[model samples]
Target: MPATHATEHSITVAAPPAVVYGLIADVAGWPAVFGPTVHVDVLEEADPERGGEQLLRIWATANGRVRAWTSRRVLDPAARTVLFRQTVPAAPVASMGGEWRVESTGDGTSRVVLLHDYRAVDDDPAAEELIARAVDRNSHAELAALKEAAEQGELRDELHFVFSDSETVAGDAGDVYAFLDRADLWPQRLPHVSRLDLTEDEPGVQHMDMDTRSPDGSVHNTTSIRVCFADRGLIVYKQLKVPVAMSGHTGRWEIEPLGDGTVRVTSWHTVTLDPEGVRTALGAEATPAEARALVRKALGTNSSTTLRHARRFAEEARARA
Candidate 1:
């Protein structure tokens, strides 16, 4: 039998058990709430005798490297617990399982405990050391962020928002996807892009460092990681470096065929504003509402520009063919 190591980390959150549980159960929102999480997708969900079972694909930063894995989870809302096991663990990890339990401490508070059990392939000491360190670091970061987000309560809504911009293309979805996937050419094709460096060390995964020129002629530098799904006509990205007034940003580009020889190409964005950054960027008395409006306008303008260019590119390509 393979020897397994177990670890636990716990934090006290000044929020109700149900509230904390809701944050954990809503896996789709982890990227915005947690520092290490980049993206999560629910592949399947079903009600089972044990509770609710779900298959999840999660992309996260582990020990400074971006990794992807599939996990099977059982969620018990009444018990305020979630049990998860990695069905496809990333490298250096042979097997991994974990549980998130939220217990009421009374007085409108909860104790959140994160537990992990894992084993390294071939019982290699080096692999074991790496996995243990990553697990500890990520668990601590996740718990701290969870506490901060949960404690924000109503304030979270003001600081976070989702928005999108789109255009219709009378061309193929593949052409639209190609235009978005080829970020390396943006500096030449897109007027707002001044310089961009893109690297794809792994297929379908891209790392980008770009300098974008704002309408005021001020250039802002940003770095991002993007995962592309050509067959699905989708590309999802998370910005590692954000603007001064933003705390987090994640977005996706989708191309959907309308079945009429045309496609709807859309850009979706989710952003969380930073209060201190907002004050610095705007003014000392700047409110969250003002920051929200500024972000919406800036991102929407850029997205709309990109969508228009993509539509033109795709249509022109079709015309030439």
Candidate 2:
């Protein structure tokens, strides 16, 4: 057996222990809450909120590299702890496991401790060092984000919103998926996209930078990391650099076949607003409600346009066939 290395990172959050625990337990929301997490898929779970065993597939950034892993977790609500072990660890990681503990510190505050233990393949020193660095960086980032989110309390709703738009395509699901997967052509295909640069360093993992022209003729540049599940017809993306009004943003494009040669394509968005950014971009008098509306319109308009174009492309292909 190889020697294992361990690390622990802790933070004091201005929130109740239960609140912090709840945030940690809700793994599905990690992409929006944690900067390193790009996407999470719940493979198996039984009421994760109440505490139980669950399985998850996660795609995240590790030391600037996109990595995917499957984890088995045991959630203990009574103890305010979550224990997880990666069943299929990524390369250089022979095995990885961790525990998330939330402890009450009184006065409506709590302490969050993230602990990790892992070993490198063959116990190679270089591999071990790399794993250590990644664990340290991700742990700190996740804890700080968790602290900020839990402390928001009632104000959380005002900052975060989830919305989606759907359209029925007259062609096959594959065609619609192809339209989204081939985003490199967006500059030529999508009117609002003035410029786009895309690279898939690793299969199914992409990094993109693009300039989009908004309704007011203003152009905003953004960058994102996308993970594609081709067989499942799902593509999840996280914006690394966002507009002035958004603190965090994640979204998905899903294609579902209707079994009769038609498909339903949807674009889903989850956003966390920056109040001061809202004012900066939309004038100081802009209220939170107004910010939500503005974001919804701007984002929805772009998404609806993509769906329409995808529909047209797919239908045209079918007619040509």
Candidate 3:
């Protein structure tokens, strides 16, 4: 018989059910919400937040070692719960599944429950314990962070947007992936980049800190965590630290090969505006219209640069192959 293990943890946060649910539903923000999570990549999005399936690539620390895995998840806002199972289980974990439940305890409060059920690799007791430790530690941190985020302010009504650009090149997807996957070498390859500090503490997972010169001639320093999905030809990144005007920022890079002997490289971004810091980031003369336009242009410019560079590099690499 396979050794099965179950673990559950709960916390009461002074926030509403919907508020708590939103924090749980936004998988991309897990790096900030959970202490152990280094990055989260959404392979496929769940649009409705309820009765919709979402596929995710998660990179987290287990017993001090970074681990990466993908999960198939379903969300149900009405029931205030989300369900997930590992689509590609990592080592020491044969199978794993879990759910998030948020129950309203009062007008301005909620009780959040996190549950997990799993069987270890080879049904070994040692593997089971390792998995349990990871789950327990992460679940607790996530719940507490969710509670804190909910009680912060009325952020649910903030503006969120995604911008993307793509370039078609006569190269293969492998070259494109190699270029983006290797960020430590970006400073030498990309001009706008002034400095870069990168670490792949875990394979396929990266912690990157870099400085870039914005269009306005101002240098901005940002810290982000990224996860690469080699199979899907995708890479996802979330900023753990950002400028004052942004509340959340997440990005994606995808390399696809077309039948016509051309490959397309695309970069995408989703960001939420921080209402309280807009004036400070932009000058006093900046209107809401101007702020939005500036943000879109800036983000689009950077992503467009990446796509173009990847195209050229990939084509050259493919030519030699």
Task: Please give the CA lDDT of all the candidate structures.
Answer: 0.92, 0.93, 0.81
Task: Point out where model 2 deviates above 4 Å.
Answer: none
**What lDDT tens digits, residue by residue, belong to model 1 across residues 1-321?**
787999999999999998898889889889888988888998997453346999999999888778999999999988989999999998889999989999999799999999999999998999999999999999999999999889988898999999999899999898999999999999989999999999985898888999999999999999998989898899998999999999899999999999999999999999999888999999999999999988999889999999999999999999999
lDDT of 3 at 7: 85
> For residues 18-119, what per-residue lDDT tens digits would candidate 2 score against the true structure?
889988888999999999999999999857557789999999999988999999999999999999999999999999998999998878899999999999
Clashing pairs in 1: none
Q: Rank the candidates by lDDT, best first.
A: 2, 1, 3
TM-score, cand. 2 vs. native: 0.97
**TM-score (C-alpha) between model 1 and the true structure:** 0.96
lDDT of 3 by residue, 1-321 (tens): 777788889998887788788878888767645556767768899876346899998877677667888999998878988999998999989999988899988777899889999999898888877888888887877777677667765643345566788899898888899999999999998877888999977687788899998766889999887888798899988787888877677788988889898988888877666656677878766555566677788888887887788888999997788
Top candidate on lDDT is 2
The segments of candidate 3 whose C-alpha lies over 4 angstroms from its true place after superposition are 1-57, 61-65, 70-79, 82-99, 106-109, 115-137, 144-157, 283-291, 318-321
Clashing pairs in 3: none
